[model samples]
Target: MATKGRRALRLLGAPHITVACLLWFGVLTVWGTLYQADPLHGLHGAVQRFFHSWFFLAGGVVPLPGVQGTSALFLANLFASMLTRFERPSRAIGLWIVHVGLVVLFLGGLLSRQYGRETTLVLADGEKASMSVSETGWEIAVLTPGAEGRREVRAYDVRNLRAGGSLAVPGVPGSVGVVRVIYAAVVSPAAGLTPSPEQVTDAPAASDPRMDRPAVVLRAGDERLVLLGEGPAAVLHLEGGGEAHLLLRRARLPLPVSVKLIDFEKKFHPNSGIARSFSSRVEVDSGGRAREVTISMNRPYRHGAFTFFQSSYMDNPRGPEVSIFAVSENHARLLPYAATLIMFAGMAVHYLPRRRRT
Candidate 1:
């Protein structure tokens, strides 16, 4: 048993694993870059398949491990090396800190990938919002119409579900069983001579997920309903008189504070239509204490654990000026900076003494 444990530790801390991971990183870099040049699969698609996913099919046939898988392997290697190789010797002290720093950085990346969220909040001039929504995720919102044109909207989570999974919609009788899903669907009116349901065919996924219109067939209370995400909500007549409206829309997260866009300003270059700089002054209201802050290209505003950066500006031809803010909630973002400093100190300890002696 001791011999087997030693062998396993040796394998985990082997230099070949490091070399293979580094080489795979290079390969993925080149492959993702080449793939990004394709119009259909842009940077987002490339990153999703190569960097974000645990596995991706190469050339649509060969299954290969992605960056997430390689990162996990490298993390294991670092931990094993720290346990089995690095010791309390004075000369090894710097190596110990370096390995520990690397582990911290890697774990931070993993935590950010697994638990962190990236959401977007769009505000037109003079508009305020307390909700930031997911860019590529969708959820089902069930609406009930009330008296005097008032309606109650309640959203349910569908992001964790697959085609075979079920979604528990509140206020509804039965759980919605997902029968089929088309991520990028082309919805067309029924074209047959006889009466039939609409035709939904899968199309190539849009580079921006917001542009993709999904179609889903759901089994809800013995009624099989086909709903398209782009159009009007599918209605389910209630036994108690009124109807329940169901629509799949972008998932949203309510913020603790409300943000209102005061004004958006843009500066253009001399004699050119190109934009030189742009910024948005926004009011953040928390507990009725409102404060105005500027968010620009280089500067991000932080409130509590949330950080908002000015991500996009749209000068809508038909309406008001729109400013989009990228909101990130990653508590582990500071770990990488701390790990970098630790690594720097380790490198100084490892090299400075040798330099002085020489």
Candidate 2:
């Protein structure tokens, strides 16, 4: 057992291990970039299959190590080399500083993987929102309308559930089965056909997101209900008076503070029609008090555990300006800066004396 442990230590401390890790990282980066270029496979798909997994089938045949596995192995190799190989103080101080910086960068990536949470908040002019919705997380909500603006809701998680998948609807009588789903759908009324939200055309030719609607079908107790996400055909009349609304929406996270968009301003470059800058004037409601603030490009609003950045805007042209804010909550958000400063200090300490000798 002692001999085996020594051999393992030696192997981990080998320069070949580091070289292999770096080469694999390069391969993964290239693979991810190439995979996302395919129209059917998006960046999120590449992340889920390549970056988040331990191993993935490349080209549906060859196996490749993913980001998590490669990084974990590389980090272990680094620590092993630090303990077993980098023992002599006579070693170059510059090398030690670079190793420490690389370690910190790896650790920061791990921290982000564990603690970073991101979502988006979309607010129209004169709209108020107290929550943000995830861009990727999907949920199916079963809502029963009660008397006069009251509703009882039960939501089921259905992120990336494919066709033929079935899930039980809580508080409802029967199970719901997915017949068809279009992640990005276009909805338009066909001539001579009655315009109904449940009426859907065939799957789109490509991901041309003009209307940007999502169409889905749910089978419930011998009745296949055609539903559109947040569309007019969302609500169904029960046997009795109340209505059942089947909604497909992103999972929501409540915020401690509510924001009301009072006004939005956008400036275009001369003769270009490209937007130079856009901003939103918002009223923040926090702890029973309200304050006004403006959020713009490069300017973020930080409150509690969340930071909101003005990321993008959706222009309605004839309607209100739709402001989209990227919300991120990262526990180790400042670690990168700390690591950068440490690297800078280490570089200065190592190089200044050597320069003086010359």
C-alpha displacement of 13 in model 2, angstroms?
Answer: 3.8
What is the per-residue lDDT of model 1 for residues 28-144, given as tens digits with 9 covering 90 to 100?
999999988998888888888898989999779999989899999999998877777775647687888888899899899988898888999999999999999997777778788
Model 2, 131-156: lDDT tens digits are 89876655677787665888877776
Q: For all the candidates, what are their Cα RMSDs to the real structure?
A: 3.3, 5.7
Top TM-score prediction, candidate number: 1
Clashing pairs in 2: none
Where does model 2 exceed 4 Å of error? 30-53, 86-101, 145-149, 160-244, 341-358
Which ten residues in a row are the worst by lDDT in model 1?
189-198
- Model 2, residue 140: distance off in Å is 1.3
The TM-score of candidate 1 is 0.87
Question: How far off is residue 189 in model 2, in Å?
Answer: 14
Global lDDT scores for all candidate models: 0.83, 0.76
